[model samples]
Target: MAATLLFLFVFLSLYGSASCRLLQTPLLDHATTDPIDATQLPTSVEASPAQVQEVANVSRRELGYYTTSCETGNPIDDCWRCNANWESNRKKLAECAIGFGRDAVGGRDGEYYIVTDASDDDPVSPKPGTLRHAVIQSEPLWIIFDSDMNIVLKEELLMNSYKTIDGRGHEVHISHGPCITVQFVSNIIIHGIHVHDCKPAGNAMVRSSPTHYGYRTISDGDGISLFGARDVWVDHVSFARCTDGLFDAIMGSTAITVSNSFFTQHDKVMLLSHSDDYMADKTMQATIAFNHFGEGLVQRMPRCRHGFFEIVNNDYTHWEMYAIGGSADPTINSRGNRYTAPTNPFAKDVTMRMDTPESQWQSWDWHSEGDLFVNGAFFIPSGAGASSNYGKAASIGPKSSSLVGTMTANAGVLMCKAGSPC
Candidate 1:
C-alpha cells in the first residue's frame, strides 16, 4: 500500500485549447437575458470519507522527500517517475491527487481503454481506441496511448464523467486541434498531455456521451474549458501559445485544482468565474500551487471573481501586467509565492482589481503572506489580513516558496522514460 500510494503522488502533481476565439469571453457578456437566473449551477462537493483518507494516505508519505533529483526527491517524484516499474503500474497515478480536486478519481473502476487511433473521424460513431471514443463511453476508464501520438480533433472534445487521460509512458500531444470541453460533469482527471495550438471547432453535431448527440455552436478555442463542472483536476500539463484562455473555470465550477504545470507565451493565462456579476461563482474554490508561470505571460495567472481561492507556492517568474487579479469581491489567500516581475515598472503590481474603486475593493478579503518579490514586484493586499476569511482554502497551505524550485522543477509534461522513472 505504501508503494502504491507514493506512485500516485508524483503523477497527481502538475498541471488547453484554442480559438473559438471571439466567443470565449465571460458568460455574463452573452447572458442574452439574465445568466444570473440560472439557479441550477453546482456547488462544492465534499469528497467521500474514503476519498479523504486516500489523499491522507499520500500526504503521510510526502513528508519524507523534497529534492529535485529523483534519487532523493519527494514522494511527488517517487509516485511515478523514479519507479522503474512504471509501465506496469501506470494507473496508480489516477489515485494520487490532493486538494478539493482530489475527488476526481478518473476512470478508476473501469477497464483500460487504449487509444490505438488518433484520428477524430466520426463523432457520431467514433472509432474504438480513439480518444473521442474513450471519453464518450459511459463507463469509467483508464485511457492510455499505445505509442507517441499527435492528435488533432475535428471539434471540441466533450468528455463524460469518470475518466483519466494518463500520458505518463509516452509522448502525447493533442495540439492544433479542438481542445477539451468539460461541462456539468464530475470526477475527471487530465494529466501529462501536451495541449497547445488549439483552434476553434463548432457549428456541427458532436458527441458528449455514447447515448447523446448534440449540436455545438462555434467555440472559443480554449485549451480546456470547464463550465459548471465539479470535481475536476488538471495536472502536469504544459501550456504554450493558444488562441484563447489557457485554463478557465466558469459558471459555478467548484472543487477544482491546477497544480505543477508550466505556462508560457500566453496572454490572459487563467480565468476563474464567468464574470464580475456571476454571483453563483461565489462558491468557487481552487488550489493553484507549485506551478511555474514562465516567460511571456502578461497577466491573470488567474484573474478571479467572487469565490474563495488559495494561490499558494506558485513560482511567478514572468508577467507584464500583473499576476493575480479579480473583481466582485474575491477572497484570495496568497502565500509563500516567488514573484519575479519583468522590467516594466509600470506593471509591477502583482494584483489587479479591475475597475472597482479603491474604497469598495479595499474591503475585499485579499492577503499575501511569505511571498518573495523580485525586480520591484509587490502584491497589493487588502481587507483584513485575517486567516479567518480564507474558508475552505486548502487545509494544507502550500509549502514555502523556498522549495518552489524543487516542487516545480519538473513542471509541464514530464518526459516518460521507459522502464525507468520519468
Candidate 2:
C-alpha cells in the first residue's frame, strides 16, 4: 500500500503541482477504488449478488445527502435534484450517478469556484472567477455560476480533471459560441446548464490548464466533447440547435453516464466512438438513463461504435430519424425506455447499423428489454438475444416504462427558486 501511494504521488507530480490535492482523494488510493473495476457498476437487467451490487435498497431520499426537507419527486429525481436545500448541498449531486459512472465523485471534495464572470474573453489566461479559469485550476473544484447569465465563449472551454460544473440555483446557459471540450481528463460532472448554438472556433493556441499551453485544431461545434477521458457524468442539461452532436464521447473515453438530462433540436445527438477502427474504444462502457430525448432530433441518438452501453428508462418523444444507431461491434442493452415515434413512417426503426452489411451486423449484440414503444415505433433486435452478455437478471431494476413520463417530467435545466424544491 505504501509503494502504491508513493507511485501515485510521483505520477500526479508529473501533471503539475496538484500532487497534494490528488493524494487527498481516497479513490486514488488504489486499494479502495480499482480503476478497471470502477466502471463495472450493476446494470438494470442484471439481478444477482455476483452480477453487481444491489444498492437499490438505498432509498433515493436517503442517498440524496440533503440537509433540509426533501420534496417528493419520482424515485430518480428524488435522488438529488428535488431537494429544496440542493444549493447548500450541491456537491452531493456527485453521488447521484449510477451504472458505469457511479464512482465519479466530481469535485465534491474541493472548494467551490463560483463563476462571477460569464465572459470567456481569453482562453490562455482566463480571469479569476471565470468558468474557463475555474475549469483549468489544478485543484478539484465545484464550479457554479453566481447569477443567472448566458455565456458566449470566445473559445472552446477546455476542462481539467476532477471538476464539477453544478449549475443549480441559477439559470446558466453556455450558448452561441464554442462549447465544452473534455480531453484526456477524468472525473467530471456537468449538470443543469443550457448548451446550444455552439459555433466552432480553434486553429490557434489555447491553454487547457494553468500549467500547460498547446495549439489546437478547428473544433467541431459540439455541445460537449469527451476524448480519452474517464468517469464523466453529464446530467440535467438542455441541448438544442448545436452545430454537431449534443454530446460526443470518443477516443477511449470510458466510465460515463448521460442521465436525467434532455436533448432536442440537434442532428447526431450523440456519438460514442470517433472511428470504427479505433480499437481502444472496445473497452468503453457507458450508461444512458432517465433522460428525455425531445423534439426536433434527427439521428444518432447515440450512434455508437465498440462499447458496452446500458441504456435505461429514457423518454424518447421525438425523432425525425432513428432513435439509436451504431456501427462497429457495439453492445447495446436498451432496457425500460419509452420510445414514442414520430409521424414519419419511414423512420420508425430504432436501430440503424450504418455502413455495415446486414449479414455482418446481424451478429452484433443489440437487445431491447422492457421498452415501451408507441406510435408504431419498434426496435430491430439482432444477435443471439444478447441475454447472456448482460450477465444475469436484475430483480431490482429500472422502473416501469409507464412511469417514464412522471419520472423524466422535469427533464432539462429546471427552474430553481430559493426556499423551494427545484
Count clashing residue pairs in model 2.
4
lDDT of 1: 0.75
Clashes of each: 24, 4
lDDT per residue (tens digit) for residues 1-422 in model 2: 99999998778778544444333322211011112121233322312222211122222223222212232223445666566687788887776676677678889889999899988777898899899999999899999888998999988899999999988879999999999999999999998999999989999778888899798899999999999999998988888888888899999999888877888878889999879999999888887877888777889878889888777778787788798999997988877777776778898687899999999988988977777777667898888863455542121146555555545656687777767778
lDDT of 2: 0.76
Local lDDT at 283 for model 1: 90
For model 2, the superposed segments whose C-alpha errors exceed 4 Å read 1-76, 392-396
Q: Would you list the clashing residue pairs of candidate 2?
A: 46-393, 46-394, 47-393, 47-394
RMSD of each: 14.1, 15.5
Error of 1 at 398 (Å): 1.9
Task: Please provide TM-scores, in order, for all candidate models, with all chains considered together.
Answer: 0.82, 0.82
* CA lDDT of every candidate: 0.75, 0.76
Q: Write one digit per residue (lDDT tens) for candidate 1, span 1-422.
A: 99888776654552112222112321211001111111222221222223211121122113222322463222344455667777788777765566667678889889888989989988777888899999998999989999999999998999999998988778889889789999999989899998888888889999999889999998888898899999998988988777888898999999887877888889989999999878889899887876778888888899999998887667787888999999999888777677776778798788999999999998998877666666667888889755466655543344444444446666788777777667
